[model samples]
Target: MVSEIHLSDDLGDSNLTVSDFANTLDAAIRTLLEEQSTGLIAGGKISNKLVELEIPEKLVVIGDIHGDLRALHNILKKIKIDKFVLNHNNKIIFLGDYVDRGLGSIEVLYTICSLKIQHPHSVVLMRGNHEAPVEFPISSHDLPKRMTERFGRRIGTEIYQTKIMDLFHLLYLITIIKGELFLVHGGVPTDLSNITMKFNEIVPNETGLFGDMLEEILWNDPRILPDGKDWENSRRGLGKHFSSNVSKNWLSISKTKVIVRGHEPCNGFKLDHDGMVLTLFSCNEAYPKFSVGYISTSGIRLHSIRNGFDLSEMVKIL
Candidate 1:
């Protein structure tokens, strides 16, 4: 049997101090930086902002927490994360957007950081559009304001700039599970003609197309158009709205069957591109009408799965 680790009981604790939160962020950032420098994470290789993993025995995917501490706690409890990670072959991937729009942003981030620090190899934290503001600033960004409300002006602003921003910079942009699945916060890259380049070889911060690819990976969404158009400017004003053909071409070029992402709000989960893409929305507090959901599956099952529609049976709704 694998040794079990204990998680903190104060997930959404009301009395968490600024110092504690800062310390947790500091530890998580250090771990991520080390992973980047060494190019190793959870027995997988890291290339720039992409993580390449040879499918784990079990994988749990959580999407867009958005400061929903209760939802996070519920998912963790439902999955029995502490016990699950004990198996060593079990992994959990958080699909980013961990902050903003909810009252418990700090608490939610604190819990996630603590989890990452405890099980560095078992947890993968991917960057979402909300976390992309460090490079591509969003006008409606409110994580700093949430921090200020929680810890007062000076301390909150200090921590947000020093620790939180550093953490965001260290978050992974994409995680590819070998020949099985392509996991990202948003949708597929629009320019599939040049997508023959391996994802691991692409540098996110490089100028020109590489930079644009990073932006699209973090901000893009999927839509089915009546016309034959494959790409269009996104209303969000950052990434493009890619059509079903875009997803198919991208998946075929990347040698992956499905694109699992978290961006659009839906009733827990939604399938796009004729079941070629799976969009998971895991927080109810951010959009109360939508139910929170996550994907829990074994790599064997995921690898054998045909498309997103068949994968829906594995989603656990909260």
Candidate 2:
């Protein structure tokens, strides 16, 4: 049975004061920094921008929110996340891209951050490419502009620099559900051999190999063509487009069955690389032609699942 989770009425409302917004951003930044310093431990352990956990009994997997506060709210209500967390063993993973491309980026960030503060153990926030500009700058970035428009120049600029940028640096890069699944904002690195070694102790802004790996995790996308090369230069200009064989080999190396990510816009969700990759797009406002959806299932069921095609059956489309 699902119980009701009452969200703040002012979350997406214009009535929310600038001071309140700043305070929430500050509180969230503090929470993330503290988590970074001390490590986050619920059932899983998060350290060095990587989250590792045993598959929970029940799990809710959300994709790119892209500032859709209504979508986020709907998912939370539909999943009964507040009630689900009461079990302590259940978890929810947000596959990044939380802000940008929509009108309510500030509200979306605030809501997720508030959820993290309220249920530190039950919620995991991963970093998306939209959240990667502090390191790998992208030309299409509009978050700063959105902030300035919403809160005015001086205060908004300060918030984006001090509060949001700091918070972005602290978001987790990837989450591993032990041998069950690999969750990231984008796609896998082309070189699977170095993954285990590099991901063990990753620094978000490091140069050379680690930097390259970070870029791929945040910007890459899976190549859907069956005959495509193992790796091809992505049209996105930053990450490589990996083929099905790469996905298979990477999964074998990581000991995970499926790669779950969110960087592409599709109708609800998409399966690529022979169902080895699941790309979920959960915001309709960003791509009006695309449907929004998320995955809600037990970790046990995920462990038994062989591919994204099978997993698609569990998606809850809104």
- For TM-score, the strongest prediction is 1
In the range 1-318, model 2's lDDT, one tens digit per residue, is: 111234654554555567777777777677777776776567787667878888898998999999887888888888977688777678898999998888878878877877777677788888888888565657535788988888899988998888888788778887889887889899888875666675554644343225667888898899865464578888997888888887887788678888999999999898987789989989998788888889999876877887788788888899
Off by over 4 Å in 1: 1-13, 198-200, 203-209
Span of ten consecutive residues with least summed lDDT in model 1: 1-10
- On the 0 to 100 scale, the lDDT of residue 18 in model 2 is 73
Query: Where's the lowest-lDDT run of ten residues in candidate 2?
Result: 1-10
Candidate topping lDDT:
1
Q: 297, model 1: CA deviation in Å? A: 1.3
- Displacement of residue 206 (Cα, Å) in model 2 is 6.9
Q: What are the lDDT figures for the candidates, one per model?
A: 0.81, 0.80
